[model samples]
Target: MVATQQTAGLSTSGRAVQAVALLLGFYLLAAAIVLGLLGLDLALYLGSDHLRPALFKIWALTAVVIYPVLRVVFLTRRPKGGESGGLLVGRAEQPALWARVDRLAERTGVRGPAEIRLTAEVNAAVREDTRLLGLIPGKRHLEIGVPLLIGLTEAELDAVLAHEFGHYSNQDVRLAGITVAGRTAIVHTIGTLHERADRQQAEDAAELRAEAEDRLARGKQPKDRSAGDGGVQRVLARLFTRYARLYFRVSESVGRRQEYAADRAAAEIAGRDATASALRKIPTLVAAQNFYLGAYATLGWDAGLLPAPGQVYGGFAKLLADPGRRAELAAMGLALPEREADPYDSHPPIAQRVAAIEALPADGRGTEGAGPALDVLHEPERTLAELEAVTLVPEAATKRRVDWPELVAESHLAHAREAAQPILRALTGSGLPGTVDALLDAVDRGEGRQLAERLPRSAAATAATGRAAREFLRPALRAGTARLVVLALAESGLARWELSWSAAPALVLPEGMAETFDAALDAVVADTPDTAPLRSLLVAAGLAPVAG
Candidate 1:
C-alpha cells in the first residue's frame, strides 16, 4: 500500500516529464530508423532522376551517409547482449542466495532480479539490460557487493536487497536502462568525433615535431604551438555534451524521484530501521575494506592471500578495534559537503536517506532465518580465493599464504644482505658482527653518517642484546625483496614481528624494549632535536614502523 500510495502521489507534472523523457529516448531511435528508410527511398528514387539532377545528387549523398549510421546505431546490435560487471551467482551455484532473494521479493510485492551476481564494489544495485526502449521487460540483474555482504548484518543485507527490489517493483529498472542507452548513444557519437579529431591531432603533432627537428638542424627557431581537436570535432563534442546535459536535467529528476519511491517501498517492506542502518553503514564499510587492502600491502602480505570473503568482516572489525578510530571513520563517512546535490548525482546524500528512512514506521518484518548472510553461498572461502587469484593476485602468488612475520623477516634479511655489501667493501674481512659494530660506533661518534646512509635501515641500527636494543624498520623496498630485511631482523632477535587479529602489523618488543629504544633514541637526538638520523638508523636496522 505504501508503494502504491507513493506511485499514485507522483505529481502530474512529474509524470508528464517522465513520459517526455521516455518519448525522447524512443524518438531518438525512431528518428534514426525513419531517416534510414527515407534514405533508402531517396536512393531508389535517385536512379530514375525523377527530380532535378543536382537535387537528386544531394539527396543521394545524404542518404548514403544516413543509412550506414542508422544501421550501425540500431540494426547491428541488441540491447540485451554485453558483459555487465560482476560474477554471476547462478541458482545452481548459490541456491540459498537465490532462495533468499525470492522470499524477499515476495514479501516486497515485486519480482526479483532475473539474475543475481556478486561484485567487488561497496554497494548493491539493480540494473536492467535490454533494447526495447523501456517497453519490453529486460533482463534485470542484482549485483551484491561482497564487501557489503561481509560488513552488514544479515538483516541489513536483506534491507539492501529489498531496496533494490523496490526499484523493480516501480519499473524504474527498465526506465533507467533506457536512459543509460540514450546517454550511451550520445557518448558513442561524440566519442567517434573525438577519435577522428585525436587522430588528426596526433598526425599534426608528429609533423610539427619533425619540422622543428629540421629547423633545429638548419639553426632556425621553430614556432611554438599545440595540436588540438579540429573545429568540427570540438563543435560536435560540445553539442553532444550540452544536449545530453539538457536531456539529463529533465530525466535526472525522474531518476531521483524513482530513488525516493524505491526507498519508501523498501522501508515499507524491509522495516525502516533495517534500511536506515544499511544506508548508515555503507560508507564506513567501504572505507574499512579499503583500509584492509592498504594494510595488506603495508604488511607486505602476499597479494594472493587476499582476505577470504568471510574474512572481510574480520578485517573491518580489526580496523575499528579502537573506539576512537571507529568514531573517526564514522564521522568521515557522515561528513558530506554542506551544499546542494550535484544535478548529475544519481543518489542523494547518506544523511538525507537516513533521515527519510527514520521517518517511516517500523514494520518488524525481518525474516526468521536471517543468520550470517555468508552462509547463503557454498564454499565462500574458495570462491573468494578464486576471485582474488583471477582479479588481484598473480597466479604464482596464489599458491602460498605468507603471513606478516614471514613478510617482515624476509624483508629484513634481504636488506641486511644489501646493507652488508658496502660495509664489507669498506672493512675487508672485518667479519659481519665486528664490521656492523664498527659502523654503529662510527654513527655514535657522528663519523659514519655516510656509511650508515649506504646501508639498509635495519642493517644500520646498532644491534644490542636485552632491552637496550629497541628499534624499528620500514623496508624501503618493493615486492619480494621488501620482506627479507624484516625476516633477518626477526631471526637475529633485534626486532620481533607481532602477527595479530589486527589488520595492521606491528613489531613486538620484549618487555620495555620500545621504552628503552625510545629513550636511547631520544637521548641520542636530544641535543639537535632532529630524528632524521635516528629514523635513518632504524631503517638501516630493519625496524621502520609499519604504516597502519
Candidate 2:
C-alpha cells in the first residue's frame, strides 16, 4: 500500500519537514512565475522601441493578477486561523481523562496535548498552533466530542483517540496547517476573482441590451457584434483552477495515505477488533445523535425553549442507553456501508479501513472492556451541559429553560398553533369565518363539497373536480378539521400534546372522548350532512349550540 511505503521510508519528523518545504516552496514558486512576467515586461520596455505603448496595456493586465497571487502568499490565515470555539478544560478539572491521554501520547511516541477541549460535533480531532508556514509547532490542542463519550465504550474511545494521536505520531498534523492553508488560499482567490468577472460581464451585457433597445425604438436594426469588456480576470481564474487542482491532487493523495497510517496505528494501540467496531459503530452513533438533537433535544428550540440546565446534551446518553434504542442501533450497525471511492476524499471508505485493520497479523492488544467512555470525565452530565450551553447553539443563552416533558409538549403546541394559521387562511379565503363552527355550518348547509373544492388541498386532490374532488379532499378536510378542533380543545383544557419518543407528538384526548373522536371527524366531512352528532360533542364541551 502507498501508506505503508510512505511511512516505512521516512521518519515522522522527516515527513513533516518535507511536507512543509514542498507546500511553502510551491507558493513561493507561483509568486516567482508572476514576478517573471513583470520582469519580462520591464525588459521589453527598456530594450524595445516599437512595442513600448503595448507594454503599458501588458502592465495594466498583469497588475490585476499580481495582487491576488501576492495576497494569497502573504495573508490567507498565515497562522492557520485561531483556535476553534469549544469548552477548554485542563488536567486540574479532569485528571483521570488527562492521565489516559498522557499515557496514550507517551505510547504513541508524541508530545501530549497542551490543551483538551470539548465540542458539540460527533467527531474528534487534534490540531496544532504552528508558526512560519507550519515549520515550528507551538501549543497543541485536542478536541473530543461529547457524543463519543456518551455513546462509545472505553475501548472504542481509546481507539478513536489513538487514531487522532497517530496523526501527530506520524507528523501528519505538522504540515497539515501549511497544506490546508495553501489550498484554502487558492480556492478563495479563484472564488473572489470569478465573482468580480461575473459581475462585470453582467453589467456589460446590461449596457449592450439598453443600447439595442434604444436602436430598435429609433427604427434601426441592432448591431450584431458585441463590444463589451473582456473577462481578463475570468481567464486568470481558469489558470489558477488548473494549478489548484495539481496542489489538491498532491496534498490529498498524501492525506489519504496518512489516514491509512493512522488507522493502522489505532489498530495496533487498541486492538484490531475494537478499532473496526468503532469505525462501523461511529456512523450509527452520529445518525442517532443528529436524530436525538432534531427530534428530542431541540423540540422547543424555535419556540425560545430548551431543556432544563444540565439536561440538553446529557439527555442524548439516556436515549442511546434506552433498552428499546439499543436493539435498533445494534441492527443499524450491522448493515453494510455503500460508498463510492472519491479520489479527493481525505479518508478512505469505512469498509476499506476496516479491511486494512483486519488484514494485519494478530497483535496481543485487545479491548479493555473498561465499561463506558463517559467514566473518563468527572460528572459528565455537567461537562456535557456546559459544552452545550457555550458551543451548541448561538441563541441558546436567550432561550427559556424547562424540563423535557414541558418543552416537548409546549413545542408541539407551538407547532400546532403555527399549522393552524394556513387552515384559518383557507377558511377565511372561502368566505367563511376561520372557525370549526363555521366549517361545520357549511357542511350542515349542504355546501361542504363547494367549500372543500375552493381551499388548496394536496396535489392529488387539487387535480380532481366535482364528486371525485370531494372524495380526494375528504381525508385532508377531516385532518384539517381535527387540527382546528384540537387547538380549540387544547386552549379550552380538553386536549393536550404528550411526548412520544418512538413517534410524533401524540395528542391526548380527554376522558370518554377517545373511541368515537376519529369517526366523528370523518362523519363531519362525509358526503351526507351529519352535524347533529358532531356538533353535539362540541356543545357538550361548552361550545355554544347552533342557532336556527
For all predicted structures, in order, the TM-scores are 0.70, 0.85
Q: Write the per-residue lDDT of candidate 2 for residues 1-548, one digit (tens) a residue.
A: 99876766565556556556656665676678687888988888888767767788888878876766665545544343777887888899899899999988988889989999988778999998877767688889999988888888888888999999999977778778777877777777778668767887888888889999999999999888574443766776777788777777767777888999899888888888788778888889899989998888888988999988877888888788777788888888777486876666678887788788878887755647558988999878788777876886677889998987798778878887887776677778877787778878877888676665665677877887777876887776677778888777777767788876656668887766777787788788776858677676777766564343
Candidate 2: C-alpha lDDT: 0.79
**CA displacement after TM-score superposition, residue 328 of candidate 2 (Å):** 2.8
lDDT of 1 by residue, 419-504 (tens): 44544443333332333334344445553333333444454354533333232211121111223323435556776655544433
Report the Cα lDDT for residue 360, model 2: 84
Best by the lDDT measure: 2
Q: Compare the candidates by TM-score and give the number of the best one.
A: 2
Clashes of each: 36, 0
